[model samples]
Target: MLILWICFLRGARPILFIDGCHLSSPYKGTLLAASTCDANNDLFPIAYAIVSAENNENWIWFLSNLKELTGSISVTLISDRHPSIIAAVEQVYDRDRHAYCYRHVKENFCVETKKLQRGIRGEVKEDAKKLLDAVCYTHFGTEFTKAVEQLRAFSPELANWLETKGDINKWAKSQFPHRRWDLITTNVAESFNSWIRKERTHSICALITEHRDKLANLLYIAKLEMTKWNNEVGPKIDKILMEHVARSEFLKAVRYGDHNVMVRGSNVDVCVNLLRKECTYLEWQMTGIPCPHACAAIKLLHSNIYTYVEECYLKSSQEKIYASSMIPIETHDMPDVNNLTLTDWENNIFLMPPTTTRSLGRLCKKRRESQFQDVHVYKCSRCDQSGHNRSKCRNPNPEKI
Candidate 1:
């Protein structure tokens, strides 16, 4: 069994994913373990496990081994929020040392909400967005409570989801500012399934052993390629930067040119465009490799924007640096094989025996459900009671009949 985690910036594509695999089966106790991290830009195996015998204690032992490997006092472990994971975290991690992947909860909540709220439109959509935005982007405080109360007025079903005995308390504590529902999901780990799909012809152990090395090799090579590509692209980036500098100067000098006329990078006046969006920096930040608008503004003021933008965030930094600190270091003094432990599931104690075999059919049964929930079910506070939300929830009392 394997558990993988993908962590990403909210509203940004994922760039970090970690995976941990257990060698044992639910029915038997043979336990093995391994883990890897993929930045998509590169993949590296951070840890590995070898199960010598059948024991259920292997899972917890394997995780304990991982804690040593990870070297973090407070690790933000994210997964599908699997029941086993929740139970495991509670059992192992001390308070405030673990967090449930709110992303998974939001995903389930969204799916359920959509099923309940059907065919909602216009202001209803806006209201639903408000409620979700409240949870995703607001701190769990008075404002968040207000947002939830707002949703209650929009739809009874939504109000119930927020207020459910099991949900409200948990959701409140898990809430954070600037987080988004889409930020959650193990999609990055899901991507690796394809990597091993064609190579799964062998049994589980064989598949893992073979691909484990293969993945390690691939990651090493990928880092090298990323370095080369980043260097290769440097000249192109410099050229673009130079172009922005020239354009900014030309735009400033020319007063005779029509504002709407076609001119590369000079269409808008730099001084009068007060809205940041109307400025060049914001525009180029979105469409160009570097902030050409910042480049232009720099040239217009004879200031060095290069110094302002950190080298780390520069396009030039595309080359991934596989810091030796990030992975295990090879030292002669280090044991050829580190400490190993085997656990017997029956007694939850250490034991040793030959590896046992179980059918992969059981493994395939636990695949995640692929479904997108309705968007309407997450209604706004204004429209909670009636079919209509705040924008459309007119106070129409029936005539005195």
Candidate 2:
């Protein structure tokens, strides 16, 4: 993991996503992870630890080790609004570098809004929720202000709740530090957790070995995959640039200076400053790729849009990230414990599985369905009735009966 961290430091962005997953094994525990994203926006697991639970003490231990590993490099950490994580980050890393995951915020906001409007009439609650989402998604301060004003007009209490929780600079793209780019969620960590879901149930030693093997294979495959890339940037980044280029077709650009231009879309006008790599919409600076407005300006000036993209997104950097190889461990590589002296083996006997209280019910393997997830209803073609498929329908055909 330390070697992986060294490679990541050489090529990956200085952004980290931290999260903890509950282990469902006989000896229950928490799998705390620190992860980052590759140039292609893929998961890059850096470090992990197994702890008894997700408490402040355990989080502090995990983060302290991470801090030592990452050194004093300035990094932006993204995570859910977990109190333990918040406290640990405050104590370990610079508080200004932490950003709350927007997805978690939305989920928590929806749950709170439902409780606040338990018996309210009309669709006011739903409207307020939608407006809150708009506020979160807005990339410009003016648009954010308008959205908040609309929410206030609908419900001042809801607006106030959002304002109290939503620190503009932490969650809003317009005010967020541009170094972290447009990553707003800790999905990179979540994705890595999902990738190792089955392995999470293993014993601590087995889990570590599994992760070692998995990471080795992932790096090897990534190295081979990136070698074939022909573009200046990664595939995902190139696709985004192409999309912005397409959008630039609908925008009109007027030059004011050598590096400044005004781009007019159908309904809005944005100022693009190529020199600073900033646009009035904040997309260019936030994403490290030119927004449609900047794309228009670059096109008008006959400049290479690729030159404006951040160097971290280049294919060469991605290759350098996976250039280091992870040696796979084999059984023969293990030392013979039977040959060890009594003193050597006795001291290691204290290490044991974590202690946890057993729950009352059967352990659930599947995740609980989200409240917002659409429930699919099976329709019976034979009787045109919902909730039962044709094959499972109790109603028989008259002729067959």
Candidate 3:
């Protein structure tokens, strides 16, 4: 399997989303990856290493290498609450620098609560989940404490699990010691695994080679699109700014001083400081872009709203991300080094099938998915319905059910 990471020595954020995905058949190992988003908010791979398994020793070695690469630059690592990962991050990085994935935390809580609160009313269970969400997402200490207490009131066991199992300062955005640039999950690394899914079954050499080519193509395509951006910021950031602008029109701004202003919305009144690019809402701090309230304040001063956006979202910064060039590989008309040249690798290396006795039921065709993930439904051509394909479809007619 192939693992990859984007170079964060320049325009990328100091935060990285790290995770491991299991390799498929013919390869017995795991691909440990660390990834970051570029200025345009696109996933950029830095480096990757393959290991025999996801264990403490392997994870430490992998993260220690990351430490060396990041040299003196304190960085934050985000991922699920995996025991090996938590232990390894603590050894290789600062305890404060390691952050847990909020999705994983929430989903884990949901799954565990169901087991713990068996036979509980659905309404009560749902209300407990809402309270947990507030606890996980609240930006203020007072709000956080109140949410936790409310959660404890409804489901003390689940609340205890959250506090004892994970640290609030690590997962909560309002509490993180440093800026994560809104990267709260390991989904970027998971996406990398899915991108290289086709290569998982291949030999290590072939997989690595294909990954190199794939990275080159991805960079080349992004570089081409960079030339087409017409605004001060990249397309997506510009779109975000436009959205904020639209939302700002509905709110009212009250000037406190040159930059300090109070933005009052229907639900809440937020204090916005255009000079510092800050808002009481905290979205400005997380995303590095002015929230709608901040935008409303910016509009009051008649300042160019584009200037309020972070430098990382600027067009120049996005260009810097793709400034490096990747050398092309001449794979065509190359020397035949496979079966034709010698005996054979793919053909000669044959293995026997499993020797286990056949089971009664049909063999499972798809991999098991995580409970948090949404299951994809396939439509059947024969029945013109969802959940099954034309072949191996149970119902042949649409109305036959």
Candidate 4:
């Protein structure tokens, strides 16, 4: 799928396709794997760690890989409601820097309720409905909280279970202000699933290899289609670039305090407070953008400063691409997916399964083994059971008995 997406994107229509699947391995049991592609027709296969749905340790192991994958990139991950996926995401992306699939969240809620809400589903049905509608980040927290509160009235155990899982308030704030409703769901991958179903039903090797070739051909075609369009866009893009260069030069020349205005660290003595008042205002307002003075400070403070300007001063870089005409273009507010063409079906492709030295959980098990530790055997104090420890003992006191 990543290969196919890469091909489709090269046609001047940059697009990425993400999907998860259950597959059997020759040595290991069934594993769930995810895959991504970029606009350059570059395929990044199994860019993430594979995890087992049944293992709690998989959640932790996946998160370590997630941290490595997401290092500072503005990334949003969409996945189904596997507990491991959710837990790993929360552990790695607590800042809400990533967007989630509302579709996945909705389906998860419904599926969990149907299977586990046997006793309380009736009472919390309305709450669940509200949560489903509140898929966008804007109202996600409010609706989710209200619904959970209602659920608490019906099933304290479930509500408490959710709370104990993580900091609910933190997660709520991070998910608010959703980018789009469709973003919340799992349909992006579904498109690929349908294609995969139609294209291949043979041996696993044939499935992986054939899909890859199909995607490569599709990408080549997309590039051919994009050549003329790119030619036209190139000159216009160059003109825009020239104008931007001039504007940036002007901003750089504008001075603050004793030094040229910069966007990096500097001592107060070396810098003048060109916009100290503005910096104060922004700080007071809790707005992250740098004030004019902060920009000035950057010039005097560091030998190289512009590198940090976008990050430190601009709360939203989207605000920087000025011009009424450019606004719509900048937004790239594409229409609904239904309006999008899945385009080339025969061209769609799948990726090769990733090679792993060990399953994800083996990291911990390996660490434990390396430590030469004894097997963690448990004994219940109350019941003298071998399977449970004292903390989990459910029987009355052994002494009393």
Candidate 5:
């Protein structure tokens, strides 16, 4: 827990990903975890606890401990729409920001769409799904509205169902707060859970020990890797910036007022304000990285573009996150206690295992497939390739039918 706090405080991002995974141990506890993305967009486990169950009380306990660990720092939390988690977050960190995982929301949307599909015809549901995807990824209010309207055209009932779920701002990128950056999913925490899947079946104390060892090794390697980075920003951010710079070549920039420029794309013109580090397209603000429009404006200014990137993506901040090393607990230093009686050890030193009731079915490790698991096959019309469509087909010539 001390190491968790140290890593979190040293990092520049004030974002947290909270989630719970069911433990496969005989105790059958729920492992509540909070994680974050490091400078390289890798999972950085912050805190975790094993509880008997996942409910309001357990969630509150976990979050309360987390609050104590993180102090009063303002943070943006991302998680699935679990009622217990929602209640606990509101109770513990009322002033902090919260965002739902878009993947979970999309799964729920698919379930509801299927319920509505009983009345609608074929392709309408598919079109609605595509529209929902568009809505989730759109970085501008107008684009989101356009996607929603398109969904409404396919099935007003499905659109209305989505509205009833809650505010679009909670799930849509265009409407989400810029503080969350481009993290719309709780994949960081999910990845952490998968990484610890094998250890999750162990006893509580053993599970915690495994977590400590794994994180210690992970941070040590990360520290060594950070020493090799020469870029101002981390490698991930540099790659993203270079891609944006490449795209900026096609954009034309016209200087406007101080710190403001108009970037003309093939179809649209976006206003880029270097002073505010924003673009009319909203991608720059949403991602904490310069978009193509902002890239064009920065090129015109002849400035170091990486300066516009958020501090969380910088190499210095990344080095700070891995500066602390986790000291290994040496077992050889402990005094020999083999002479102690079993009864005395049980009464004074040994702790009892948690009581647990075995569930009915055989223990299963695989997750059930959701309603969105249907596979869609693509075939090229030009060369009859199975994996690609005609527009993207690599074949230069095709047989005439």
Candidate 6:
């Protein structure tokens, strides 16, 4: 909590990826966490709590605790469309900044399309997926509408499901109101969950202390890495800038005014205002990096492209974000109760864990992995062919042809 307060206040963006994962043995509870990205585009965990279950009440409790630190400032919280999470965010924070993770929404879209399939084959569901993918990636309203119309062409019911179940403004990149950058999922938070699986098998104290140690080490590594950065911007931002610079080489920039430049080439006709750091495509504003159009304009004026980037993507911000580190909590000493008086021992009440019944199934200690998600294709050893094992292989017969 101390590190979160100090580092986040100084640097990291006001965007959180909140998620919950089941704690394994020793503490059978749900670990709810709030994490955000740093200037280097890496996972930076803020806070976590252990709850008996993932429900509306627990989620509210978690977010409420988080709200105290965040204060009244609006934050862009990206997560799945969980009913509990949706309800919790609406109550804890304003719903205007709540954005849906595109991946989760896409998974839901796949679900609805599968429902629409209804054992049908050769229905061109791939085309439907492409349309939805375009909608998710597009930033322009016209492009989004065109993509949605294409999706509607595939099936009106499927399109209706997307509109009704998934909010276009929340999940669509072109329509999202906040500065979420390129992150569209809770992947970092989920990575945190998976990273601590072995630690979850230990006692609660050990699990927490281990988390601190890992974060402390990570920060130290980041500090060392920061000294090596050659560019003014963070590594990720530098890569993006160079890529934009290369792409802008094809376009021709014509000065319209003191700050405005009209860029045209390869089907690109857009306006770039170097002074305002804006582009007609809106990519520069949304991503905090100069787009190809803006880069072309900057090149025309012989100005530094890095000057157009937002301050949040710079090395200073990255350093401030990782400046604070957690001190390891040593637990070598344990207070012995043998010297305590009998009266003192009798005065204190120690409560045991609550009684619980094991559910009637094989206990799951990790995430629910779909069996069909990673099916292996068998190859025949005898014939040196694919798709069938040696036992099941039908060897080619020369006489049969």
| Candidate 2: stretches off by over 4 Å | 119-126, 165-169, 175-179, 330-345, 349-351, 357-366, 391-401
Model 3 lDDT per residue over 160-245, tens place: 88788757788887778877877777888888888889987876767778888898888889889988888888777888888989
Q: Report, for every candidate in turn, its global Cα lDDT versus the true structure.
A: 0.44, 0.83, 0.80, 0.41, 0.83, 0.81
> What are the per-model C-alpha RMSD values against the true structure?
14.4, 3.2, 6.1, 21.4, 6.0, 3.2
Provide the lDDT at 185 for model 2. Answer: 82
lDDT of 4 by residue, 79-165 (tens): 555555566667765535344455444444555556656766455766764543532332334556776676566556545654664
- Against the hidden true structure, what lDDT does model 4 obtain? 0.41
Clash pairs (backbone) in predicted model 3: 5-45, 5-46, 5-47, 6-45, 6-46
Model 3 CA deviation exceeding 4 Å by range: 1-7, 121-124, 329-366, 376-401
Q: How close is candidate 4 to the true structure, as a TM-score?
A: 0.37
- The window of 10 residues in a row where model 2 has the poorest summed lDDT is 392-401
Error of 2 at 305 (Å): 1.7
How well does model 5 score by local distance difference test? 0.83
Total clashing pairs for each candidate? 16, 0, 5, 20, 0, 1
Please give, for residues 243-281, the per-residue lDDT of candidate 5 as tens digits.
999999999999998899999999999899999898988
Poorest lDDT segment (10 consecutive residues) of candidate 4: 319-328
User: What are the models' TM-scores?
Assistant: 0.48, 0.89, 0.83, 0.37, 0.86, 0.90
Find the number of clashing residue pairs for candidate 1.
16
Model 5 Cα shift for residue 187 (angstroms): 0.7
Candidate 2 positional error at 376, Å: 3.4
Model 6, which residues run further than 4 Å from truth?
Answer: 120-123, 330-333, 336-366, 370-378, 388-401
Shift of residue 192 alpha carbon in model 6, Å: 1.5
lDDT of 2 by residue, 1-401 (tens): 67788888898999999999998777788889989988888888888888888899999998899888779788889998899999999999898899988777777777767776787654766776688778877886788899889988877767787778656567765556545688888889889889999888888777878888888989889888797776888788889999999989999999999889999988999899999888988777777888889899999999998899987898867977887898755678565657777886777753477766665899787898766669998977778778887788887552232
